[model samples]
Target: MLEARDTVEHEIWWEIKGGTSNVWYENWTKLGALNYVVPTDYPINEELVDVSDLIEGGAWNDQLLHQSFPADIAEHIKSEIYIDQLQGNWDRPWWMLTSTGRYTVNSAWNMLRHRDHEDSDFKQLCIKGVPFKIYFLLWRVLKGRIPTDDVLMKMKIPIASKCYCCSIPQQETIQHLFLTGQFATDVWQVFKNAVGIHMNLTQMKQVRYPCLKNAPFLWNELIDFLEGYKPILVSKIVYWNLPYDGWYKCNSDGASRGNPGPSSYGFCVRNCHGDLVYTECKELGINTSMVAKAMALKKGLMYCFENDLQPLIMETDSLIMKNVVEGIWECPWSIVAEVDIIKKLKARCNVLILHVYREGNSLAYFLTNLAFYFAGTSRFNSFVDLPSAGKRIINMDKQQIPNIRIRNAKNTSGMDIFT
Candidate 1:
């Protein structure tokens, strides 16, 4: 009929035939009809079996398009081909029947799936290349896939050696490195002293094995305790100034540049009889001048609170800082918070913030200079005799001062002593 029709009719007939071919091909694929190739001696009578039987129990009725092929079959073809694209195997020739106007979806899915599988295989190979014991230990520690200690001990180590620090005969493991080793105990002591917290130092198995296995919060506490204390201890110091009776005087200062750059703070406490009680210096990392001021204030407060000292007078060259602390003027929000903390600490002691001329704050200035010198090498936390270099500088400054003091003292007479 199509062959005998005029050009327009023939074109429509040809389109109908093509559409039918595509639909048949898609249905055949879904029903597994294509699994068997065309047989050489096919039975002519039964050649086209009723494919409709295969569609009865499946997802056919939900997709009928009001076309031919029992409503169910029509629906099946429309849905599986148009919506789900089940025959969409673009990697081979199978996808041609299922794709809509274009077959690119099948092509894209195949390419992406292949690439993903290849990348996954590559990663597996990379992981397999790592040494077995090292990999297992790291995996156990990181992923909580730990084997029993006995099983771990039986596993091969690249280097067969007992623990280095403790010399006890046992396989080197993360547990041993952190728990049983003498070095680990030393580290724990420093940790305990710094935070003022103590815990039983014993074998990993003794400290609640399940804490290591499931309680991540407890594990983190151990890690944080170990990591935080070393620096804190190195920076801790006792400082005092002024001697009573026969005691010597110790003075301290804190300075910051550009508001929040590297800061230097120092303190030297002297007994009533003029004997040096203790001295300390510190170089604080980038922090506001206000922060440095607060830190210095805290140091004094801590010293007084810890030592049971009274009538303690802390001095800084910053008059504005002093006034702010005394509530004589409003402080910037940044400074106020620190001032408030200091005030809270101050309430526990006989503490006073005295504003002095930068000149009068010479000892603190000298200590700050020393702090800068020891910035990276060591933290100034203990009572050390004055460094020779600092002593020389102090003596030199003192000697040069006699020549100028008389004239300055006369000129400055009647000025407010506090000013």
Candidate 2:
């Protein structure tokens, strides 16, 4: 039995080139047998020959092979010449057991234990934004591996297993503790009300807890996924400031009273030193804020083009506008014409299109608000002789004052339409 096992292992193994393998006895072929052998009647100079004896003039010697084996076997062996076979040094053993040709106990155990089981819920629990600890705890709970009171009691740990949150003497379990209990129901209701989601609790609970295997995994995975998804659009704070030297920073904003109500686009341009170069507030007839934003960008680009403002950096607080201009997103058909105009103007000079926090773009936001008090378009070419409010906000930007950012809060509104 041992010899049979050795033969099987030997048939599947080969030595690397630098080994002390006897070319006559060692199984060097991937087939684990000699491809050609010395003919029985042939006479040889020595009892053993190494592979180097077969090489002459940097190539396999046809004369030596023909002298050792018949033409048929010699031709077959010559045709099977492999690059690695010819170039390798005998460094280590090569086995066909693992991918790396080197095996470990862990790899063998995993190979033996691999079975196709439904583990989709466990996989989905590893959602990108969820905390790792939360993912691990929920995974354990779904696997019935958590040390809950009932589980601890079953393991001979002294503990009461009854539900304590309500007056009922029900045994405490994952389902009863988190889904069916009165306290749990009230907590879920608060979450439901806050998120504006409604579902029949009895039906959900009925559908949730029956399985000793599948149901809990699906339900827990879904709950954790929603909890993980709730924070994707949470507000972030980013400071805005002046452009690099030899560049003009233009910040534009678009505002509307209603979805299709009175709107305007406003932009304020400043040099690298935060000195205001110009401000424009032009009235836009009934249009969506999206259209106002598109027009505002086009107007800002055109202003730079006409004024020969080379190496400009145009910024906007609208994420939508930034995406549209950078070609990361497509604009609506209504705004495509304006976007094209902006693109043509952008191509004429070195322009950097950027997105800034509304706090950083407060001067442009203020200019848009100024449009609210005006019945017609307003254009100011110089900071001097400007209104006190305008001067104050500009001064704030110049001083690099830190503005307290509020999430999802709008501080100003208006639009600009430039021909």
Evaluate residue 70 in candidate 2 and report its C-alpha lDDT on the 0 to 100 scale.
Answer: 65
- How does each model score on TM-score? 0.35, 0.43
Tens-digit per-residue lDDT, 162-281, candidate 1 = 655664556656666666667777888898778655554323433544223322346667666545632111111112234334423335567777656888777656456433456667
Worst 10 residues of 2 by lDDT: 410-419
* Model 2: per-residue Cα lDDT over 74-116, one tens digit each: 6744643322234446523544445344645564444445646
**Reference-based TM-score, model 2:** 0.43
Best by lDDT: 2
**lDDT, candidate 1, at 321:** 73
Name the lDDT of candidate 1.
Answer: 0.49
- Clash number for every model? 24, 11
